[model samples]
Target: MIVFQQRYPVAFTIAACLVCGSAVAQSAIEHHVWQDKRKFEPYSRTAKSITGAIRLSGNPDFATPGSKMTMTFGNGKKVGLTSVGASWRQWDETDDKKATAEAFKLSRDPGHLRNGNTLCGDPQSDPAQYVVFLERSTFGDSTRLLGMAVFGSKEVPHDINSQSLCGTFSYSTD
Candidate 1:
């Protein structure tokens, strides 16, 4: 295509509109840095989400019983996080299943809360909300509490932002 838009004109117009097919409704995190800038790709949308065994928040007796979690959402759901520590930097806004992710479900659910604890009756969050520590904590209390996320506006389920978001959060005991 004209030598890739004269040698990469912004990654050839975003990879020629994602390979020029038309029907574009995709973005669970797919940025080839505009094109081959590498890293960041998780766009598998056949609407596949079925689940069980999603434990995060650590210290559940040294957490070791069918653990798994993977998550990333942007461009519409807009959230992909992982700071790697600080008990995921608590931010508990009276818990509403962590405020999003469709009331945090799929069966056996109990993982979502970035209300970032204001301590005892929590209120007053935003501790640099940008969490994405997918399925961590194999004991030793590294505390990367499963699939928690935040970046742009995590005020809580006061309304909007919850389209069953998940890249691949697996933790099945079935």
Candidate 2:
């Protein structure tokens, strides 16, 4: 009976290893350069663009905050983005489940005053706030929406803090 029990555990261990190995083999990694556009209202202040790069891993999960990212513009300008917040949305046949990985406010040294309050909504909400969406793609890397709202302390007429898609993007596992 002792020998049978020992063999059973060994078999279980082998089976577990095989399952985990298969999952790792099926997973993949990719990077994407994305272009986004944002248009504001009233005065028709239109067409602001930003180019960004994202590195994505398989299993359709969202990336964690502080996962190094960079953005470039049309005139050969570039900036590194420090991800302050991230939320993952899992889609089923009927509904979606959202999970927040990090919750914090973003503040640029010069302040992002292009399209006020367009990307991220009210900042007063507890646990922070995020908008997540899943886009159709042949590549495993999906589209993620991120933003925040900045209230002017005393000066400025509450300009919207935002970034939009612009320029070409490439995807690769390497």
Top model number, TM-score: 2
Off by over 4 Å in 2: 1-3, 6-64, 90-135, 138-174
Over 1-174, each residue of candidate 1 has an lDDT whose tens digit, in order, gives 798789889998887787774556655542111111112322122112222222232221111223222232222222222222222222232233331121121121212222222111212332322223223232364533233333223322222233222233322111
Query: Which candidate gets the maximum lDDT versus the true structure?
Result: 2
Give per-residue CA lDDT, model 2, range 28-141, as digits (tens): 553211212221111111213222222222212234455433333223333344444343433211223432332222232221224442222233332112212222232255
- List lDDT for all candidates, in order: 0.28, 0.30
- What are the runs in model 1 whose C-alpha is more than 4 Å off? 1-82, 88-90, 95-129, 132-147, 153-174
lDDT of 2 at 106: 25
